[model samples]
Target: MGAEVLADKVYCYPFQKVVTGYLNKYPTPLEKNVTAVTTVEEQTDPATGIVYRRRIATCNNIIPSFLRKSREWIFKWSILKVTNIYLEEESWLDMKARVMNLKCRCLTWAQYASMNEESVYRESKHNSNWTEFSQKGTITITGAGYLNCILERFAQTFLKQGARKSIAIMEKILEEKYGSPVS
Candidate 1:
């Protein structure tokens, strides 16, 4: 059997009004039955002479997207789950360093990505530190792992042409966008 799957996702329910004339948003069913199991299994262990089993609780909020008057509708969401909830001081520091690096690259890449090429002025604007863009309008920036995967897979296309030539091409593109820089 696989390790226990802990709940990470949440849902939102709509407001309901009863004949009593009071309106309230429906509370999540799992609030009261925290340990209620939606899944159950049977197992026997000779060492302890007792059964060892696991359970999963499924009761949760009703999402309006899949709402029904007669049936409770639950939406499943993907959540980032850290396997070890507790972090050591050094480990946390290492994680912070790695995350900072990743966020730096993401922010750098996002700046250029967020611009509308048709109206953009320069690559420096894309490289600027303080420029901000609406998250809704910009593409969702992915983390470093996925970005690395993409870069590694396509490294030949980007790197094979040689770095100096690529730099020249980039500078030319920038000049076209913003006009030649002062000497």
Candidate 2:
């Protein structure tokens, strides 16, 4: 019914540079599945000095090929019938704290299945010049018979690949912006 995915990484760059790279690396060719990203809401809290952003990322439908043929099952469950999948994301940035946190949730198949992801980037405890990144996600699938387990496994595998791709993109972004690796 559910599965958890966790990932961690360390970037040999300052927190600011790492966070900047993450913010700018999205919607790139590495994430071809992602079609578009739109900011829905943005605000700066004067009291806390935290910047908040809400974005919606539209992605190509990646439903398992096996499920693609089960049109009746999909239609009966009233899942996402469209070709595009939408993911809602919210991010909080604390410049003074040199930290950023992001949360993402799937919107297209919320009823039948859900994928929620959370990520954090902050100055490393050991070195201010380095950034530590941690990410975790939970995938829950319901309404499907035996396929729920299959879908969960597929989601876990897909998410691992996504993490690797994102890291590569982040590295490319940082190198392009900062000339070379910091450490």
Candidate 3:
């Protein structure tokens, strides 16, 4: 089975400020779950001037108690590969990230479960002083095993809660950094 979550918000800050804040958001108080971020690759298109960056972020897993029994077999460290592309001319940024269990062999059972998230930030079409941000996320769990099905149900709830909490934190941080968003 699979579940999808979407969120949209606007910031009162200009596109440039919003984008800069996003890049520096990890070290903020809002993202306590994130432990470390490492730049795995980065490059710039000399002709188009588009910037591309890839990073690996490590976060703590907040698995439910029932799932805690298999925590070791589930996930030791949640590692996500985040890719970002910035269109300087258009004042647009697109980011996509994915989490897979293959990186941690101990979490073999979680191989069937994967999560993907995509977000886009751009200058508002109506106002240059505003920035529009939208995010879409999907979680997929598929396996014929009975254990997998049980885990999927728990995972769905876990992911939904995590997404909401993360969004709230992000909005709070943005408000603090750029002031209240334009209604």
Best by lDDT: 2
Q: Over the full model, what C-alpha lDDT does candidate 2 score relative to the true structure? A: 0.85
Each candidate's TM vs. the true structure?
0.17, 0.93, 0.69
lDDT of each: 0.22, 0.85, 0.55
TM-score of 3: 0.69
lDDT of 3 at 9: 71
For model 3, what is the C-alpha lDDT against the true structure? 0.55
Per-candidate Cα RMSD to the true structure, in Å, reads 25.1, 1.6, 8.2
Instruction: Report the C-alpha lDDT of model 2 over 1-183, residue by residue, as the tens digit.
Output: 698889898888999888777776768876789888898999999999999999999999887665666467644754645689999999999999989999999998788888999999999998888899999999998877777898899899988888887887887788778877666
What candidate 1 gets wrong by more than 4 Å, as runs, is 1-30, 33-36, 62-183
Give a tens-digit lDDT track for model 1, residues 8-72.
Answer: 11101111111001101112231332213322454555554443333333322221222223321
Model 1: colliding residue pairs: none
lDDT of 3 by residue, 38-87 (tens): 56666666765556666665565555445545344444443211122111
Q: Which candidate leads in TM-score?
A: 2
